[model samples]
Each structure stands twice: as structure tokens, then as C-alpha cells.
Target: MTGMTAEVMTPKEVETAKEAAIAPKFVTKGVDVYYAEKQALTNVSLDIETNQVTSLIGPSGCGKSTYLRCLNRMNDTIDICRVMGDILLDGADIYSREMDVVHLRARVGMVFQKPNPFPKSIYENVCYGPKIHGIAKNKAELDDIVHTSLQKAGLWNEVKDRMHEPGTGLSGGQQQRLCIARAVAVQPDVILMDEPCSALDPIATAKIEELIDELRVNYTIVIVTHSMQQAARVSQRTGFFHLGELVEVGETEQIFTNPKDERTQGYITGRFG
Candidate 1:
């Protein structure tokens, strides 16, 4: 299990390493992945800093989703996915055999491109994770978790009066927010969103962007977005992946304005995908 171990260092040790040191909530080093002998990600190395948003942008089939799935070992659910890399969270290697995928998922949550709320009441959806994880002992405790999670997801104000309504009965934006609340209920250390706004309207997207900004105060966020503007608005840093390779990575302003790599420049300038 070539999990993210070497990419990590103690905070004390990291402090002396250099100013460029990541202080990462998670790190990936020399990561390679393949599905049935077809490579999906190649020699990918990057750092995901704590309390910040990192956006992965590129053309389709660039392996952004693959890389995101590797963070929580979600790819393990696929039989053909062969992952070779190190993914570290809070200075610990996460791909080791000893690592618990269930628990790992609890710490590292994910939101999909489409809003796929469970077929249950809104309150049930938000409380599901805590129930499975045994995070709450009684109704009061569960209510607090649900309330806080919904508040963090920015849905409390809209849905507090109708917590018993079916989650799937909500509009697309509300459903998406419910999913966000569901993910938050687990109190994840990091959250991965794969094109979370693709199915949303501009207004809904803006709300999510705002929620993401607020989420940065407590949780590290990584989003795979196709909208360059959304990336610019919601992320502090951007990583551009191309054909399964991470072509460039840097501050969002530099990557969007004055990219260092020719490929990056071309992609940003709309010359090529």
C-alpha cells in the first residue's frame, strides 16, 4: 500500500522545512492509478492545504475524479481500479491495509456532480451519518448534529420549518444543499466535490460557492469544477490536469492569469482543451 506517508511531516518539522511547505491536511506523492491496465492518473504529486479550497480543472477524462476518489479509497469499491500512490491525511498514510475504509470515509467525505439525496425525510438524510457512526446517543444529540450540519451547509434557514419533508422532494439546489449537509454531519476533516455545480443553476451555484467559502474555516475542500470562474471564485489554488497528468499547479491567480506551462497557458486562454 503506497499510501501518503512520506508526503507528510510533523507540524514542528514542517515549520522548519521552508515557507513553501504545504502544512497540508492531505498530500499525494508519486501517485499512479490504472483501471484494467489503462492508466488514469500518472505520477501525480500535490498538496492539499488545510482550511482552503483546491480546485481541479481540466478537460474531460483528465482523471480529476479518479484522483479525488483515491483520497478516501472510494476507488476500492471498483474491482478494476488499481491505485499505486501515497495519500496522507493529517500526517498519516491512508492507503495502508490497516486503514479502515469505512472510518476513512467518515473523515473524508464526498459530494457528487448530481444531487442524489436518499429517499427519506430531510431530517433523516442529515442524521443518517451520525447514526451509522454512532455519533449521537439520543434525540437531542441527534437534533443538535442535524441542526449544526444544516446550518453549516447553509440550508437551515430554508428548511428548518420543514425538516420532515422528503429530501428528494426538494428542488435541485435544495437537494444539493441537503447532500452537503449530509456530508457535513459526519464532521469530515476534508470534503471532495466532483463537479458539484454542474447540475445547478447560476443562482444555486453561487450559493454553493458561498457555502464553500464559509466551509473553509472548518474543513479543507477540494472541488473538481469545469467552470473556470467558479474555480476562481471558490478556490485559492488550482491544479490543471490533462490526459491523466497534472500539467500545472499553483495559486489560482497565477494559473488563470499567467500560467507557467505552455499547456496551462493554452488551456486557460481557450486555445486548446
Candidate 2:
């Protein structure tokens, strides 16, 4: 044993190392939100993996949307809102003073509860983000970005011939897709959707669900949905929130079928929200 050594790792240890190498896209710990004197979220901690759909399912006002907005600092728009805790994107603090809110929002785009496309033409609706973010330099570049974004959003063929038409002129589903296209045009690493299909018909909702599944291949998606069925259909991971706290989180299948927490089981069984 003249200063010689041999090292070996078991299969379990090797797997643990591999998992540790791939960090989560977003890591939130002890996040609390306040609007004036009222507390909205309390000590919530969660890790959102990259390129996966993570659904937040709970009753209305459970702070699901509040947590989603925290990812991009959307709550800052509210005069009385204040957020505290650590939120990390790519292991960097998103809530730090050095973080640029505008750029952070560009990296983490949002789709609202309703389809709120700009009043501009469909092309403009998709082009605006790229233009403002300087993602496109010239006419041809802008055109390409708009086209590609629409394609990613699964609305290209439906609206290609109507690029110049007002975005608001499209049907509810198409308009929602247009809003998604707008968010994609910014080339975000993450997308936040808040009850995106609540206003659409069942058919349209199905289409949006399909698009969400497809988009997860390239972008990390966090969706706040009231429909447990939608969450089961679209997400790989699911988190149950109740009364401003995260009750449980796990694989979508496991969460719905065999939740560890009784609260999760009760909610899944329709006992209570």
C-alpha cells in the first residue's frame, strides 16, 4: 500500500451523482408574498426541473398564481405587493438587487388566464417581443422570428394567411395560441401559464393541452390550473397547493393515484379543494 488508493462507486451512488449534475431550472425556498397587510403565500418551497411541465393544481386563491408570478416578478406591478425569500434561476438569485426585472421577464415569459393578445395584427403580436428584446435585427430576421414562433405555438398554418389581421379577430383558441407565440418570440427558457384554458371551449382546451405537452420538449413550463384532469393530462410533475401552502408535490401519476399526504388524496378524490 505504498501510497496507492482505489475508489469505486455503487450503482446507486453513480445514479445519485448523475442526478445531482442536472440541477433544477428554478429553485424556490421559503417564499412568502404579501399584499399590503395580507399574506398570500407562506413558506413555499419547490424545485421545477428544466424542459418539463409542472402543474400547480388547487382551488382558486390558493396562491398558485401568486407563486407563478413570483418566477417573473409579475407581482411587482401591484402597488401593494411585496415578496420575500429566495428564488433561483439557473442557480442565480432572481430576487437579488442585481437582477434586471425586464430581462428576467424576457427569460421567463407568461401567458395570462385569458387570451390577451395585443390589439395589433397577428404578425405584430408575435413580432413585438422580438423587436423590443432586440432578438431580431432586420425585416427578414423579424419575419423569420414571427414565423418560427407561430410554428412553435402550433398556430402557423391556421393564421399564416391572416398575418396582417388583428390578433383579436381570431377565435379564443387561436388568440390564446397567438399569445403563446408572442411569449415564445422572446426565446424564453421558461413559460408561466395561469389558467390558460379556463376561457376556452373543451375542444380548444384540448388543443392547448396538446400544445403544452409539445412545448415541454424545449421549454420549462409551469401551469396553474384548477382542472385536475388537465394537470394529469399535461404535466409530468404536479404540486398540490392549499390555503397558501404547498401540501404535496410529486410525479403526476403518483400524485393523482397514490399521494402521500391525506390532504392531497382528499383533494384528488373530490372531498375538498
Candidate 3:
């Protein structure tokens, strides 16, 4: 496994692998990202299945977050960042000249590592994206979306009485859940979470993990988490990245119990992280 290369598969091997994999929602081929002269990702090709939770696990600065940002063109926000690859969302190229970055973001929403909610009220924070995207036509529709998003995020019951309160006033855990509610309000095709539980306590983290499992039924989810146990608990598929490259990817159980790459094995078994 030490000599294993990056997805260098024969036609037969590719077909064999496909036999076990679900059809992809996002197809990334030779995806690469560069910040100034430094390369962040190198020829990463992976398929994210629809209606499933796929987790990306790696050490710090190993390009896990960089690669996750590529899903919805989030990297475009950085002036020095340059992306080269074909990232197709449902067979349509996301980086095509005709692609609308705003629409793309609406279709694929993101939740950051920290709970960076707006300085507005909890209800306003949840309603902000839907209003901007014109997802809600009237007050009733807006209210429905807000209610459903918070309900789905497991925060409605806790924060319902305080709808007019500022989002920053909530506890760290509640703030994070509010952020999740905000992302869900847009009704995106895919949800990208970057260490969403990193700032949370065990109870808060467990609740978020439960919400993730429930959300996968309606939306495809891709998460970047540092904790191996969290990945095992929440994700169906797991991808291990090392040194700006994807070392291996497979079913979560297989990746944990029988890794094909030495790097993946080392990272998982506390040999190195």
C-alpha cells in the first residue's frame, strides 16, 4: 500500500469499483487549486454520491478545507486563488462561463468551522439567505422556511421563544445550530460543513451529529472533520487526504477497519495525525 498511487485504475478496476458505489452527484476530475504559486490540491478526482454523508478527514493544512470549498466555488472569494479542473454538479460544469456563482452557492450552501452568525436576530439570521435568494415570495412563505429550517436543525424548540433575540446572544452550541438552520433555509442540493463541531461540547457535538444523519435523506452532505470517531459516526463514505493529495477513499467502515493505503492506516491508528 505504500506504493499506491492516486486512483490509477484500469477499465476493469474502475467498473469493479463502480459496482459498489452509488451514482455521483458531484464529479470532480483533476481538480487543483493554487494560491499564488503554491498548489493546494493536486489532481483530486472523487465522486460524491447523492443523498449520502461523505466525510473528508486529514491533518491540519492538508487541503481538506481547500478541496471542500471547490464543491461550490467558494474558493472564488479569494483573489489570489486559482482553480483548474472540471467540477460538475449533476453533469453541469460549475466553473463554466455560463455558471452563476451566486446560483451555485444557493444550490450548494456552506457552514463554517465557527458559528459565524450575522449580528441580527435569530429569525432574521435564518431568513437572510432566503430573502436574498428570493426563495420566499411573501411573509408567510418566509416564516415557513424559517420555521422548517430551525426545526430541521434541532434548534427551533430551544430558540423559538427568542426569535427576536440576537443570534450572537446564544450559547456557542446554540449559535452553531443557528448557523446550520441558516444554511438549510436556502434548501441547497448539497451542504458543506467544515469542522462544525470543533467549537462544541460533547453533548452539542452529539446533537449536531444526529442532525447530520437526519439531513442526509433530503440533501447530499460533505463534511471536513478532524475527529476520526466523528467521521465514523456520521458519514457513510470517508476520504483520507495527505500532503495535498487524496490518499484513499472508501466506505467508512472499510476505511476504518481495512484501509488500503499505509498513509490512511497510519492516520487512523494514531501512528501519526
Model 2: how far is 152 from its true place, Å? 0.6
lDDT of 1 at 161: 94
lDDT of 1 by residue, 176-273 (tens): 99999999998898899999999999999999999999988778899999999999999999999999999999999989888999988887788993
Q: Would you list the rank order by lDDT, best first?
A: 3, 2, 1
lDDT of 3 by residue, 70-115 (tens): 9999998899999998899888999999999998888888999899
TM-score of each: 0.92, 0.91, 0.91
Global CA lDDT computed for model 2: 0.91
lDDT of 2 by residue, 193-253 (tens): 9999999999999999999999887788999998999999999999999989999999999
- Residue 245, candidate 3: alpha-carbon lDDT: 94
In candidate 3, the residue pairs with backbone N, CA or C atoms under 3 Å apart (3 or more residues apart, or in different chains) clash, namely none
TM-score, cand. 1: 0.92
> Runs in model 1 with CA error above 4 Å?
1-22
